[model samples]
Target chain A: MNLETPALIIEEGQVRRNIAKMAGIAAACGVALRPHAKTHKLPEIARLQIGAGSKGITTAKLAEAEIMAEQGIDDIFIAYPIVTEAKLERLATLSRRINVIAGVDSLEGATAMNETALRRGVPLQVRLEVDLGFGRTGVPYDHALELAAAIAKLEGLQFRGIYTFRGFFMNGAPTLELEAAGLEEGRLMVELAERMRAAGLEVRDVSVGSTPTAEYAARVPGVTEVRPGTYVYYDRMQAVLGSCTLDECAAAVRVTVVSRPEPGRLVVDGGSKTFATDVGPGAPPLHLIGYGHILEEPDAVLERVSEEHGMVRVPEASPLRVGDVLHIIPNHICSTVNLHSRVYLQDGGQMRELPVAARGAIT
Target chain B: MNLETPALIIEEGQVRRNIAKMAGIAAACGVALRPHAKTHKLPEIARLQIGAGSKGITTAKLAEAEIMAEQGIDDIFIAYPIVTEAKLERLATLSRRINVIAGVDSLEGATAMNETALRRGVPLQVRLEVDLGFGRTGVPYDHALELAAAIAKLEGLQFRGIYTFRGFFMNGAPTLELEAAGLEEGRLMVELAERMRAAGLEVRDVSVGSTPTAEYAARVPGVTEVRPGTYVYYDRMQAVLGSCTLDECAAAVRVTVVSRPEPGRLVVDGGSKTFATDVGPGAPPLHLIGYGHILEEPDAVLERVSEEHGMVRVPEASPLRVGDVLHIIPNHICSTVNLHSRVYLQDGGQMRELPVAARGAIT
Candidate 1:
C-alpha cells in the first residue's frame, strides 16, 4: 500500500463482525445497546452501530453529542456531569431538538440543569450516575437514592434511570474474572433501581457494562442497556482481558520502520503521538508487555515510545528491515483513535479515509 | 472567566517571557536558538519565536515543516528521519521553498531521500543523528563516523552536521544532575563532530539539547544550535527537572470541579483526554505524584484520570466547591497541547483563541 506511516487503519470486515456480535449478545440478553461513540468518534461508525440495532449513542462530553447531533444522530446520552452554564445552555438547546439525556450525580448539577431546562422550556431527561465501586465519578451507592429522589423532584427535569461504570471489578476489587465482576456490576445497578422504585421514584433504565463486561453484564436479568465502546475495535488490553480474540480486533496503526538502530532494536515512525500512552505496557489486571502488538511479527515487542518514535525490541535474528511496514494493535483503541484526525478504512481490497468528526471534542 | 471547562489556557505575558529567556540563554552561549515547534504547534507562536531572535524553528515531521513554511517561516529543520516515499515527496516539495534540513540516522532513509532529491534535482541538506545513549533513535556512537561518511557520499545529499537528543542523562545513567548531564550531552556531540571533521566531512552545525538540557548543552564550544521545545510553556515535569519554576509555567488547563464524590476526592471535568497520559504521574527522575498540579489548591493531587474525569485527592477541610474553576499545570505540555484543537490566550484582561495548526502532523 502506497500510504504514509503512522496511519490508523480499521478493517471493515472485523468492525462489522464485532458490531454484529455485540449487538447479538445484547439482543439475546434483552438489553438495548448504546455503543459509546467516543470509541471511534466517527459518524459513519455511529451510523453503522445504529443500523445494527443500537438504541442510541453515548458520548463523554456534550461537544461530542453536538457533533453527532449535527450528523443526524437523534438520541445521545452525554454520560458526564456537565456543570458549566455555557455547556448547560448548549445542552438545553440540544435537548430541544433531540432526545438528549444528561448525567447528574449531585443536586448542584441537577439544579443547574433544571434551571436551564426551565428557562429554555425544555424538560431535560437525566440519569443518576451511581458510584458502584469505581471511585472516579458518580454519587456514592449509599447516597444515590437520596440524590435520585432530589433530582426527580426538580421542576424541569425527568429522572429517567440510573447508570454506573465499573469496568472489571468483583466485590469492589479489580479482577480478571469477567463473568463474576460483570454480574456484580449488573446486580448492584439492578438492586439500586429496585430501591429507587420502592421509594416511589421512576427508574426506567438501568445501564451498565464496558467492552470487557458487556456480555456477562447484559446477561444479568435487570441490565436494561449496555454501553460498550471499545468492542467495535478491540485492542491489546481487551485481547488480554479475554473479551475478544486478537483476530477480532479491527483497528491497527500502520507504521514504517524508520531506523534499525541496533541488532535487537528497531524504531518505527509512530510513538505516543500516534499510539497514545493512556494504556501503559505493564498496567495492572492486564500486564500487557508492550505499547502495542505487531501483527506481522508477534515476537517483536513495542517496548518504549517517545513523542514521535516507537522503539521496538526484536530477536537478533529477525529479518525486519529499516523500511519494513508493520501493523500494530494499540493497547487501547479509544485513546489512540482520539489522537488522529482521520483514519483509513480497509474494505476487502479497497481503502478510503474517514474524518474523525469529533476528534477534539473535549469541551 | 465565562469559559468552557477543560480549556487550554496560555498566559501571553509568560509566553513572551519564556521565549525571551530561552533566546537569551542561547545567545549568551554563542549558539543559535532553533526552538522546537512541536510543543506549541502554532504558527503564530513560531512567528513570535522568530521575532524574538530564533534562528529558525524545528518540527518533528515534514508535514509540520510544510505548515510552518506555508505560514511564512522560511527556515525549518525536520528533526525526525523522513523515510517513506510519500513523505519524501512532501519533503522535496517543502525543501524547494525554504531552508529545510532533514535528519538521517541510517543509509536506507538517506538513500530514499537521495533518490527523491536526485529525481527532483534538489540537494537535500541532511544531519546525522548520533545515538549518545538515549537508546531511542539515532545511529550508535561507535558507528557515527561511518554513517556520516556514507551519507556524505550520497549524490543528492549534503551532510551538514550531527545532532542527538539525550535528555537528563549522566554517563549513560538517568539522573537528576542537570548540569553534568547537559554538559556531557553537549561534549559527546562536539567530540563526534570533531571526529567527523577529521574524517574530512564538513560538520558545520553540531546541534543538540532538549528543554532540560539546552542551557548547559549550548555552552559547549562546538555546539552551534539548541532545540528546546517545552521551554516555551514550562510544564510540571520541566519544573520538577529544575528547568523552570512553577510560576514560569505559562500554559495550564482550566477545569471546573464537577463532582465531590467523597470527602477527600473531587472529580474535575478533565482527564486523560484533556491532560494527556504521555508523561505519567510517577515517571522517573521527576517522580511527579499527580497528573497535574492545581494552582489554587497546592496540596491537592490530581490522582487518577478516566477518559473524561480527573479524580483529585484533596484535603478533607478544603473549601473547593462544584462549579469552581481551577487551573492545572500539566506534566507534559507538548502532549497536552496536541490533545486540543484551539487554546485560549490570556493577555491581561483580553482573551482570544489560537489554533494548534500542526497538531496531528505525525507522518
Candidate 2:
C-alpha cells in the first residue's frame, strides 16, 4: 500500500486475534471483559470488542465516553473522577440516555456529582477508585472503605462496588515479575471488596487490570471485570514485558527515511509528534532501547526525536536509504494512537481509514 | 473562567506582546522575522505574527504550509525535507499558488522534488538545511557546499539559501550559556553562507535560530531571517532558557485538581495527553523539575503522570484542595498545542475559542 509516511497503520488480522485471545482469557477465568476504549479511541473498535464478548467499555475521560455513546456504544464506564461542574453536567446528561458509570475517589468529587445527579433527576452509578499504589489518582487504599460509605450515603448516586489500576509495580518501580505484581493487585482488590461486602456495603463489579496484568488478575475469583486497554493493539512495551509477541502488535507507524545525513544516523519523517514521548527509551523494567522497534531493520533504534524529525541509529553497513519506507512499532500504542486523527486499517487485502472519533477527548 | 479542566489557554495580551517583542528584535537587527507556525498551528496566530511585521511564516511540514496558505497567510517556508512523492506533489501544488520554499538536505530529496516541480511546471524555491551539530536533520556541514551546488544545478529548483536548527548546544550538551551558544550558531551559519556565495552560488536567505537563540543569531551579519517558533507563546522551556520570563508565557493548560489522594499528593485531570511528555523533568541545562509549572501553587511539582492523571507533589502545609483550578505552563508549548484541537484565547475580559487548524498536520 502506497500511503503517506508517518501514517498510523492498524493490522486487522492481529487486532482480531488479540481481541479474541483476551476475550477467551476472560471467558476461561469466568470474568467480564470491559476493554478500555482509551487504547483505540474509535467507536468501530469498541463495537468489535463488544461483539467479541466484551461486557462493556471503559474510558479514561468523560468526553471519550460521550463520543462512544454518540456513535451508538451503549454501556461505557468512565473510570476517571469527574470533578469539574461542566464535566459533571455532561456526565449526568449522558447517564440520562445510556448506562454510564462514573468513577469517584474523593468526597468532594462525589458530592459534586451527587448534586448534578439530583438536579438532573437521574441517579448516577459510581464506583469508588481505590488507589492501588499507582500514586496517580484514585482514593487511598486505607480510606477506600470510608469514602465508599460516604458515596453510598449520597441519595442520587449508587455505590456500585470498587475499581483500581495498578500496572506492574513492585517496590515503587516498574517490575518485570508481572505474575507476582498481577496476583498481588488482584488479591488486594479482592480482599478489599470482601471487606466492603462484609461491612454490608454492596460491592458488585470489582474492576481491575491493565494490559500487562489483565489475565493474571482475571485468575482471581472476585475480579468481576478486567479492563485491558492496550491488549487490542499490543505495543513494543507489551512485547518486552512478555504480554504479547512483536508480531501480535497490531499498530505500526509507516515512516519514510527523509535524510541520511551521516553514516550511522538516518532521519525519518516521524518524530515525537508521530510516536508520542510518553514512554521514553530510558523507561525502567524493560528498558527497551528505542522510541520504537523498526520492523524491517531490527537493529535500528529510533534514538532521538524532535517535533518532526526522528533520528534513527542504524548499523553503518545497513542498506537503509533516503526515501525508503520503514514500519515502526511504537513503545506505547495508546498514546501513539491518541496523537493521530485517523488510522489506516489493513484488513486482509483491503485497506480503509478509521477516524479516531475520540482523538482529543481529554476533557 | 468556568471552562472545563485540561483546557489549553492562550493569554492574548501576552501573545500580542510576545509577537511585538520578537518582531521588534528582528526589526532592530535588520533581519526578516518569519515566526515558525509549527508552534501555534493556528492561522489566526500566524496572521497576528504577519501583522506584527513578520515577513512570512515557517512550517515544519508541507501540510502545515498548505493550511497556512489556504488560510491566506501566504509566503511559506517548509523547513523540513520533503522525500515522499505525495508530499512533493502537495508542495509543488502549494508553490504554484504562493511563494513556497522547500527544504533540501540530500541530493535524492532534491531530485524527487525537482521531478515534481518539473512535472508541475513550477520552480520550487529550496533551502539547504545544514547540520549545525543538532544531529537530527539537515545535511552535514562539510558536504553542504557540494549539495548546495548540486541543488542549484537542478533546473526546476531555486537554491534560495541555507538554514539550520541548533537550539542550545555547547560542546555536545545543552548549555546555560545562551549567548555563547547562540553566537556560535549564528557565526557558523554565516560563515557557511559566505563560503557558498564565494563559490558563485546565489545564497540569499540564511535562516536560523529557535526561540531561545533567535535574537542572538539574528545579530550575526549575514543571517537574513530568524525562525523562532515558540516565542509567540513562550513555554516553560523558553522561560527556563532565559528567552522570556515565566509571566511572558502566554499558553497554559487549565486543569482542575480531581483527587487529593494523599496528604502531600494532589492529582490533576490533565496528564501526558494534556501536557505532552516531549520535554521531561530531567531535560538538560535546566533539569526542569516537573511536567508543568503551576501558576497558583508555584511550589507544587507535577511529579508523575498516567494517561489521564497528573500526580502533583505539594508542600504538607499547602492549602490546595480537590476541585481547585490550576493553570500550568507546559515545558514545551509546541507539542502541547498539537495535542489540543482548540484553545481559549483570554484577551482582557473577553474569552473565545480558537481552533488549532493545523494541529495534527504532521505528514
Candidate 3:
C-alpha cells in the first residue's frame, strides 16, 4: 500500500512477535492471558493471541466485543464500566454467544447487572474492580471488601473475580517499589477473595495487570490472570514509563515531509488525527525538534505535532529533504492506534496494510 | 435526547445562530461564504450553512465533499494540500458530481494533480495556497506567484484563485490586528491575481477563514469566500482563541461521574477518548480534574483525562457522589467531535439524538 505520510505503520512481524511474546509470558506465568483486545481491535491479532495461548480476549466497548464474537471468537471481557440500558441489552444478547466478563464497582451497578442477567435468564459474569490507586475507577481499597461481598451475593450474577487496571503505574511509581506495590495490591486482592470464600462464595479468579505492572502482579500468588494491552506496540509513553526500551517498542506512525518552508521547522502529514496529541506525564507537550528520531535513532523524541502536521525541529540541519519520510512512535500507542482504521507494515521499504480491526470502538 | 454522560450535545438554536452570524458577517463584508464542511462534517449543517447564504461548502477531504455533493451541494473546495493518489482518485469521482476546487502549493503537486486528472479524462480545479507568514502547508507568499502561474499553464487544471488559512495568525491574534492582517493578506492575494492576469492567466477566487479568523477574514477586500468549520460548535480552545464565548459555542460532550472514591478526586465516564487531550500553551499539563469543565464556565480548566475515565480534581470540598453527569467542552472541538459516531443532543438538560452526518468522512 502506498500510504500517505503520517500514517500509523504496524510492522506485521513486530505485532505478531509482540502478540506471541506476551502470550508466552502469560503461559509461563500460568495465568489465563486474556490479552486486552482494547489495545488492538484487530480480530486477526485476537486470533493470533488466542493461537499463542490467550484464553479469550477483552474489549472496552460492547460493539467491539460484539464484532469480535461475530468473527467467531467467543469468551470476551469488556473492561469498561457498563451502565447504560442500551449496553445491557447488547450484553444480554452477547451472553448467549460468549462468556462475557463485565466490570462493575458500585453496589447499584452490580444489582443492575444481576437484574439484567435475571431478565436474560442467564448468569452475568462480573469482576469486582478495585481502585488500586489509579483514582480513575472502581471501589476504593477500603470499600473493596464490601463491594466484593455484595457482588458475591448478587443473584443471577457470577462473581468471576476481582480486576484492577494499574494504568497509573507510570514513571511516577519508582520501578523497585512499583513491583512491590503491585505484589502488595495482589495480596490485598487475595485477602478480598479470601473474604468472599469465608462468606461461603466461590472465588475462582483474581486478575490484575497493566502493561507496566503485569510481570510483578503475575507472580503474585492469587492473581490468576493478567491483561496488559500496550505491550503489543509499546509507545514512547511506555518507554518513558519504563515498561520497554525504544527498540522494543515496535510500532510507529510513518509520515511524509509535507512542508519545510523554512529553517528549524518541518511539517508532516501526521497530525493529531494520525499520531494523536497524547503526551504522558512529565513529557514535553510534543516530542519536538523531531516528530520522531528518523527510525535510525530509534530512541529519539518526536518533539512536535499540530492538528494536520508535526513540527520536527531538526538538529542544526536535518538530512531529511522536503519529501523525506520518517517513522514516529506516538507517545501513547493505544490511543494513537485507535485513531486510525488501518496500520501499515514497512519491510525492506515495502509497506503492507493491516486493518486496525477496532479503530472506532468509541462506544 | 436525555443523554447520558460522555455524550456529544449540540444546541440547535446556538448552531443556527452561529451559522447565520458568520453568514451574515461574510455577506455584510461583500464576500461569499463557503463555510468549511470539515468543521461540522454534517450534511444537515452544510444545508444550514448553504441556506444561510454560503455560496459553497469547503471540505478537507474528498469523502466529505462527496457526501456533500450527494446531498445536492454543487460547489465544494477541498482546502488541504492533498497529494495522495487514493484521494486524487476519489477527487476525480467527486469532481464528476460537484464543482471541486482543491488546494495546491507546490508545482510538483499541481503537476501530479493535473496528470491524475488527465489520466481520469477529467479537469482538475485548484487554488494556489499562499503561505502568509503562517508556516503550515502552502507556497510562501514570494513563491505563490510562480506556483500559480505553473498550475494555470498545466493541462486539465484550472487555477481558480489563491488561498491560505490564518492558522499562523498567532494563537489569539488580537481581533483588530487579525482583521487588518486578513485585509492586508487579501490585498496581497488580489495583487497576486492581478500579477497572474497580467501574465495572461485568470484568477477567480480568493478564500480563507477559520473559527478565529472567519468573522474578520471574510471582510478582507478582494476575498471571495470564507471557510470556518468549528463555528457551528465552538470549543474551549475557540473560546480561548476569542472566536466565541462558551454560551455561543454550540456543542459540549456530556459525561457522567461514575465514581467518587474519595473527596477532591472524582472520575467520569468521559476521558481522553471523548474529550481529547489537546491543551493550550500552559504548564503543569492540564490534568484529570473535576469535569472537563462545567459547560456554563468554558474557561474553568479541566485538569485530567485518562482513557476510560476522566479524573477531575474537585474544585471545592463538596460531595460528588456516583451517578452525577456533567458537560465537557473539549480543548479541541474538531477532533473530539470526530471521535464519536453520533451525538446525543439536549438543551444540556433534555435529550435528543443526531447522527454526526459527517463523522466518518475519512478518505
Candidate 4:
C-alpha cells in the first residue's frame, strides 16, 4: 500500500470484530452500548458503533461533542463537567442541534449550565456523575442523590440519569476479587439510581464502563448503558488488563527503523509524540514492561522515547536493520490515536485514510 | 483577558527577551544563530527569531521545514536524517523553492537523497552528521571523513558542513565541568570538519548546539552556526536545569481549576495531553518534581495525569476554588507546545492567536 512510516494502521476487520464483540456483551447484559468517541474521534467509527447497536457516543470534552454533532452524530454524552461560560454557551448551542447529555457533579455547575440553557432557550439533559470508586470527578456516592435532585429541580436542565467510570477498578486482568469489587460497585450505583428515582428524579440511564470492568459493570441490574471506548481498538493496556489479547488489538503504529547505532540499539521514527508514555491504566503488572509491545520483535523493549525518537533495545543477536518496517501496539490506544492527524483503515488489504475529526479537541 | 481554560499562553515580551538573549549569545560567540522551529512551530515566532539576528531557521523534521518555507522562511536546516523516498521527493521539491540543508549520517541515505536530487535536477545541501557522543544517529567521528568524501563526490548534492548536537552534555545548566565537556565535544566536531576539508570536501558550516551547551559549543573555534530551539520559550525543565529563571519562561498553559475532589487534591483541565510527560532532556534532579510548575501555587505538585485530567496535590492550606485560573510552566515546552493547535501571544497585554503552523509535522 506504500504507507508512510510512522503511520497509524487500523485493521478494519479487527475493529468491526471488536465493536461487534462489545455490542454482543452489551446485548447479553441488556445494556445500551454507547462507545466513547474520545478514543477514535472519527465520525465514521462512531457511525459504525451506532450501526452496531450503540445508542449514542461519549465525549470527554464539549469540543469533541461539537465535532461529532457537526458530522451528523445526533446523540452525544459529554462525560466531562462543563464549568465556564464559553463552554456552556457552546453546549447550549449544541443542545439545540442534537440530543446532548452532560455529566455534572455539583449544584453550582448545574446552575451555570441551567442558566446558559435557559438563556439560549434550549432544553439540556444532564447525567449526575457519581464517584463510585474513581475519585477523579463526580459527586461522592453518598452525595449523588442530593446532586441529582438539585439537577432535576434546575430550571432548564433535565436530570436524565447517572454516569460513572470504573477507573479505580482498572488494574491488571480482572481477578475474582476484582470482579466482586466491580459487582459491589455496580450494586452501589444501582442503589443510587433507585434513591434518585425515589426522590422524584426520573433516572433513565445508569451508565457504567471502563475497558477492564465493562463486562462485569454492564451486567448490573440497573445499569442501562456501557461506555467502553478502548474496546473499539484494544491496546497493550487492555491486553495487560486481561480485556483483550495483543493479537486482538485493532490498531498499531507502522514505523521505519531509522537508525541502528549499536548492536542491540535501534531507533524508530515514532517516539513519545507517536506512542506516548502511557504504560497502562493504574500500575502495570510485572509481565507488562516497556512503553509498548513491538510487533516485529516481541521481546524488544521500547526503552525510551523523546519527542521524535523511540529507542528500542533488543537482544544482542537481534536481526533488526535500518529501513526495516515494524508495527507497535501502543500502551494506551486512546491517547496514541489522538496524537495523529489521520489513521489508515486496512480493509481487505486496501488502505483508506480517515481524518481524526476530533484530534486536539481537548477543551 | 478572559481566556479559555487549558490554553497555551505565549508572553510576547518574554519571547522577545528570550530571543534577544539567545541571539546575543550567538553574536557574542561569533556564530550564526538559527533557532529551531520545532519548539514554537509558528512562523511568526520564526520571523521574530530572524529579526533578532538569527541567520535563518532550523527544523527537526522535513515537514516542519516545508511549513516554514511555505511561509517565506527561505533558509532552513532540517536537522533530521531523511531516509524514505517520499521524504526525499518532498525534500527535492522543497529545495527547488528555498535553501534546504538536511542532516545525513549514512552513505546509503546520502546516496538516496543524491539520486532523488539528481532525478529532479535540483541541488540539495546536506550536513554530514558526526556522532559527538549523542549516539542516536550519525556516522562515528572517526568514520565521518570517509562518508563526507563519498557525499562530496555525489552529483547534485552539496556537502555543506559537519554538525553535531551536544545531547550528552545536556543535563543541568552549564557547570564549569559541563562547559568543558561542551568545549571538548566542539573541538571534536571542529577536528572532524578539518579532516573532511583535508580529504577534499568543502565544509562551509560547522554546526553545534543544544539548549544547555549552546553557549560553549558556539564559542568553539571554526564553528559557524548554532541552533537552540527551546531558548524561544524557556520551560520548567530549563529552570530546573538552571538555564533560565522561572520569570524568564515565555510560555505557560493557563487552566481553570475544575475539580477539588479531596483535600490537598485538585484537578485541572490540562493533563498528559497538554503538559506531556517530559522532564526535559536529561534525568531530573531532586528539586525538579512533577510534570509542570504551577504558577499560582508554586508548591503544588502535578502528581498524576491521565488523558484529560491532571491531578494536582497542593498543600493542606490550599484556598483554590472551582474556577480559579492558573498558568503552568510545562516541564518541556517543546512537547507541550506541540500538543496545542493554537498558542496565544500576549503582546503588551493584548491577546492574539498564533496558529502553530508546523505542529504535528512529525512525518
Candidate 5:
C-alpha cells in the first residue's frame, strides 16, 4: 500500500518476536505475563500476545479495558487507581463481563470501588499499588499492608494482591549496584506478601511491571505476574537504555520530507502531534538526543517538533529531497501510539492498517 | 453530569465571547476572518464561528476539510503543504464538494496539485506561503514570487495569493519593538502583493494568521483575510502572553486529584497524555512554569507529567484531597485539544459533550 505520510508503522515480525521473547522470559522465571495493552491499544496485538502465552492483558484505563472486553478479551487488569464514582461505576460494569482487576492505593479509593461493586452486584478484584521508588502513584511500601488489609476487609472487594511499577530505572541498563537494588526491591515486595499472608490475608497475585525491571522482578520468589507495556514496541528510549536493541523496536512513524528550507535543515510532515515530545530519560552512556531517531540518516536529529512540523537537522551535504519518506523511531512508543487513530503493520513487504482500538482512552 | 476525571472542559460563554472579539477585530480592520478550525476541530464550533460572522474556516489538514465539508462547511483553506499522491487524491475529492484552497511553497507541490486537479477535471485554488520569520515551513519571501508565477502558469491551478503565520511571536504579547517588527512584516507582505500585481498576476487574497499577530496583520493595507485559531480557546499560555485574560480562557482539562503522595505533592489523573508537556516559549515576565495552570489554585504548578500521572506541586498548606476535580488551562490549547476524542462544553453551568471531529487528522 502507498501509505500516507505521518503514519504509525509497526513491524509484524518484530512485534511477534518481542511478544515471544518476553513471554518466554516470564515462563522461564515461573511467572505469568500480562502484557500491557495501553502501548499498542489494539486488540489484535493483545490477541497475538495471548496466543504467544500471555495469561491476560493489562490496560491503563477503564475505557481501554472496556474496549478489550468488547473484543472478547475476558481477562483485563486496569493498572490505574480508580477513585471517582463515575469510573468506579464503569469498572463495576466492566467487572461483570470480564475478570477485571483494579488497582487502588488509598482507603477511600478502595471503599469507593467496594461501594460501586456492591451497587452493581459484582465483585471487584483489586491490587494495592505500592511505591517502589517510581513516586508517581502507589502507596509507600510501608503503607501498602494497611491499605491492603483494609481493602481485604471491605465488602464486595477481593484484595487479590499487590503491584508496583518501578519506572525510575527505565532509563538504562541497571548498573551492578542498581541491579542489586532492584533485586532488593523485589525481595521487599516478596516480604510484603509474606507479611500479608501471615496476617491471614490471601495475597495471590503479586504483580511487578515496568519494562526495564520485568525480567528481574519476574524471577522474584513471590512475584507471580509481570505487566510490561513497552516490550511489544520498544522505542528509541528503550534501546538507548539497553532495554532492547534498536533492531527489536517494532513501532516507527513514516513521515515525508515536506520542505527543505535551508542547506542543513528540513521539515517533515510528522511533528509533536504524531511523535509526542516525550524525551524519555536520557541514559548518558547512549547519548540519544532530540525527539526521535531517523532510520534513513542515523546522524540526523529531529531537533524540534511543533504541532505538525518536525525540524530535522542533517549534514549540510545530505542528499535529502522533498516528498522522500523517512521512518522515525519515537522516543516513547506508548505516547506516540496514542497520537494516531490507525497504525500500519509491515508484513512481507506489505502494509496493513490496524485501528488503534483504544487511542485517547485516557478517561 | 457525573463525569470522569481528566476530561476537557470548554466554557461556552467564554468561547462565544472569544469568537465575537476576534470577529470584531477583523471587521474593525476591514478584513475577512477565517478562524482556524484546527484549534477546536469540532463542526459545532466551526458553525458557531461562521454564525459569528467568519468568512469561512481554515483547516490544518485535508482530512479536517473533508470532515467540515461533510458537516456542510463549504469553504475551507488547508494551511499546510500536502505533497503525497494519496493526499492529493483526497484533496481533489474534497475540492469536488467544497471551495478548497491549498497552500504550496514549492513548484513541485504546485505541479502535483495541478496534475491532480487536471486528472480529476476540477480547478484547485492555491496560495503561496511566504516565510515572515516563523522558520517552520513556507518559502522565503524573496523566492515566493517566482513560485507564485509558476503556479499561476500551471494548468487547472489558480494562484489565489499568499499567506504567512508569524508563529515565533506567539510566546508573549509583542513588546513595543516586537509590535514594530510585526507591522514591518505586514508591510513586507503588502509589498509582496504589490510586486505580484505589478508582474501582471492577479492576487486577490493576501492572508495572515496567528492569534498574537492577527489584529496587526489584518490592518495591513493589502491583507484581505486573517486566520487565528487559538482565539477560540484562550489557554493559560495565551493568558500569560497577554493574548487573553485568565477568565477569558475557554478551554480547560478537568482532572481529579487521585493521590496525595505527600504533604506538598499531589497526583492527578491527567498527565502528559491529557495535559501535553508543551512548556511553550515561556515569557520571563509572566513566570509560567510546568505544563498547565490550575484554574482553582492559580499558583499551584503542574510540576511534572508522566504518561498517566500529573505530579502537582502546591503549597504544603494546600488542602487538596482525592476526588477533588480541578480545571487546568493548558499551555497550548491546540495541542491539548487534540489529545481528547470528545470535549465537554460547559453551557449555562451544564456540561455537554462534543466529539472532536478532526482530531488525529494530521495526514
Candidate 6:
C-alpha cells in the first residue's frame, strides 16, 4: 500500500541495528539499558528493543508506562517529575503492573509522592533529576544533593538513585569531549549516590543518559543504567552532534509536493503538523537549507513550514516536482514521530506496505 | 480524573451554546450547518452540533471524517484539496459510510477523482473550493467559472457546491464593514452558482464562511451553507476582532505552574504544544498585554512560551506561586484543541470529563 504523505516511516532493520548498538554500549560498561520509549511511542518498536536485551523502558509520563505495561512490558521508568494528583494516582495504579520509577526534583514533590504512595499502599520508586545543563527542568546541581537526601528520608518511597539528562552535552566541541563532560556528570551522580547510600538509603540504580551521552554513560563505572531515547530513531540534531550519521536515522516522514506556488518554492503536504515546530537551541534556520533535509534530495533541506504547507525552497537546478514523493529527516525525530498517529515498518529498502501496530501511544 | 495540566478544557455548556447560535444563524439563512469538525474532533461534540440542527459535519481530511464516522457521525464534507492515491482511497471508504464531499482545485485533481469514482464504482460528491481571499488553498476566484465548467463535465461526480473559508476576516476591517465584505464574497459565490446552473450543473451547495463571517453569511441571499468551526471555541483573535468577549470563549487550556526558577518568572506545564504557535497574519503580538493573559488575571497576558516552558514574567510583588493552576486562552482555539489527546469537558462552571475521540486526525 502507498502510505499517505505526512506519515512517519521507520525501517525495522535500521531500528534493530541501532538498538543493538545502544545495548552493546550499555553491556560493555555493565550498565542496564533503559531505552526511552518516548522517542518511539509505538510499543512494537519498544518490544523490538526490549527483545534485544534492554533492562526496561523509560517513559516521560505515568500514563505512557501504564499503556506499555498493559501491553505486557513490565519494567518501566518514568523520567519526569510527576506532582499533580491525577498523575500520582496513575503512577500508583501502574505499580501493580510493573517496576515503575518516577523522577523528582523537590522535597515537597517527594513528600507528596510519599504520601500518595502510602495512601495507595505501594512504594513509589523515584530517581531525583539533577540539572546538569539543560536548564528546562530539574533541580540545581547543588540542590540535587539536598533533594536526594530529602528523598532518602521520605517514607513509602524508594530512592533508587539519582539521574540527570545531559541534553546540554548535545553540542560542545567533539564527540570525545562531549563524552568526557558526560563522564564528569556521571561521576558527580556516583558521588551523590554514595552520599545517599551513606545516609542509609538503598541507592543501587544510578541512571543518566540521552542519545548524545549514550557512549559516555556506558563508560561511567558507577552508573548503574543509561536512559537514551532518541537513539532508537536518531534525528538531525544527533547527526550534527556526531552522535550518529544521517544514514543511521531510522525514522523519516514521507511527504508529497502539492504546490509550486512560486518559483524556488515547493509546497508539500507535510508542514509543522507532520515535521513539528521544534527548533532546538542553535538549530540552523529551517529555511536556511530546508525545514528538514529531503531524504530523496541528499543536498536539499525543507526551508520552512506553515500549518498545512511546507515551503521547500529548492535550487533552480533541483529536479524535484509537484506530486513527487520525498522522505524528510526531521530536526527532532521523537517530536515529529509523536505528531503522527501511526508509523509504517519497512524492510531495509522495501516499501512501507502495512501499518505496524502500537503506533499512537498518547498517554 | 484530575485533568492533565496544559490540557484543552472545553466548557460543554458554552460550546453547546455556541453551536446553537451558529445552527440558528444557518437555519435563519436557509443554509445547511455543516460545521467544520477540524476545530474539535470529538464525536460527542459533532453529534451535539448535528443534533442541534446542523445539516452535516465538515473535515479537513477523509481520515478525520472516518474517525468521526467510527463514533457514528455521517454526512461529512472534506473541505481541503486532496489528490494522493491513499487519500483518495480513504475518501472513497468514507463515502461508503457517509455522504463524503471532497474538495477539488485543478484539472489533475478532478481527473484523479473521476478515475477514483470510476474505479471504485462510487459517485464522489465534490465541493469546488473558491479562493475568495485566503491565498493558501482553493482555485483562484477568476478561474472558478472555468473549473466549475470543467468539474460539471466529469462523470460519476456530483458538483455539490462552492465554498470559501473566510478565515481571519476579523483582521480585514471593523465588524460591520467586514460583514459587508463577507456579503460581497457571498454574492460572488451566488453569481458563481448561477453561472454553474447556467451550464446545466446542479448548484444546490454554495458554502462560504468562518467564525468572523458567520453573522454576515446568515443573511446572504444565494448562500446555501455556512461552515464556521471556531465559534464553538472562540480564541483571542476572535475576542480581539469583536466576534466575542473573553468570557464567551468556550475553550481554555488549564495549565499548572511547573517551574519558578526566578522570582518574577513562572513556568507552566503548558507550552507551544497545548497553546499552539498558530499566530495568524496581522494578529496582535502574543501577550502584548505581555506572552499570554492569565485566566485568573483576566488582566495579565501569559507573555511567552518556549517548546516546553511558558515564561510568565510577572510582577515580583505578585503572589503567583509555583503550583497555582492557570487557565490560558489560546491565540487560536482550533490549533490548541488539535494539540491534545482528549479535551477535558465541563458542565456549566464545574469541569466534567469527556473524550476528544478525534484528537490526532492527521492522516
What lDDT is obtained when candidate 4 is compared to the true structure? 0.83
lDDT of each: 0.91, 0.91, 0.72, 0.83, 0.85, 0.74
Q: If both were scored by DockQ, which would come out higher, candidate 2 or candidate 5?
A: 2
Report the C-alpha lDDT of model 4 over B1-363, residue by residue, as the tens digit: 667778999999999999999999899988999888888998898999999899999987888898888899999999878888888999999988888899888877888888898899998899988876555677777788877888899987988998887673333333434477667777888888887778777899999877867888888888898888898898887777667799999999999877776678878888877887745223434256777888889989887787788878888789986767889999888988888988899988699988889888888
Q: List the residue pairs that clash in candidate 2.
A: none
Error of 2 at A344 (Å): 0.2
Name the runs in model 5 displaced over 4 angstroms: A119-121, A169-181, A280-287, B169-178, B280-287
Clash pairs, candidate 4, are: none
CAPRI quality of model 4: medium
Task: Report how far residue B153 has shifted in candidate 1, in Å.
Answer: 1.4
Taking the tens digit of each residue's C-alpha lDDT, what string does model 6 give over B1-363?
556676777888888888888888887778888888878878888889989999888887667888888888878888777777778877887788777788876667778888888899999989888776545556767888888888878997888878887554333333435577678778888988898789777888888877877668668898888888888888877777667888889888787776554466656776655666545223342223433447786645466554445667667777776567898888777666666766788886676666666766666
Summing lDDT over every window of 10 consecutive residues in candidate 4 chain B, give the lowest-scoring window: B168-177
lDDT of 4 at A53: 93
- Predicted candidate 4, C-alpha RMSD: 2.7
User: DockQ for model 4?
Assistant: 0.53
How far residue A261's Cα lies from its native spot in candidate 6, in Å, is 5.3
Better of 5 and 6 by TM-score: 5
Residues A1-363, model 4: lDDT tens digits: 777778999999999999999999999999888899988989999999999999999999888998999899999999988888888998888888898899887776788889998999988889888886565777878878877776888889988899887674333243434466667767788888898778787889888877777778888899888888998999987787677898899999999887776677888888877887644323434246777889989989887677888878889899887778899998888888878888999999699998889988888
Once fitted onto the true fold, the runs of candidate 1 whose alpha carbons sit more than 4 angstroms away are A169-172, B170-172
* Residue A176 displacement (Å), model 5: 10
Model 5 Cα lDDT, one tens digit per residue, A1-363: 878788999999999999999999999999999999989999999999999999999988888899989998999998889999888888888887789999898887888888888888898999999887667788988888877888899989988998887765433343333355556667878999999999999999888856777888777788889898899999997787678888999989999998887778889998878988655324343456878889999899888777888989889999997888899999889999999999999997888998898999988
Please give, for residues A112-176, the per-residue lDDT of candidate 3 as tens digits.
Answer: 77888898898888887887766577788788877787778888888887888765543344343
List A-chain TM-scores for all predictions: 0.98, 0.98, 0.91, 0.95, 0.95, 0.91
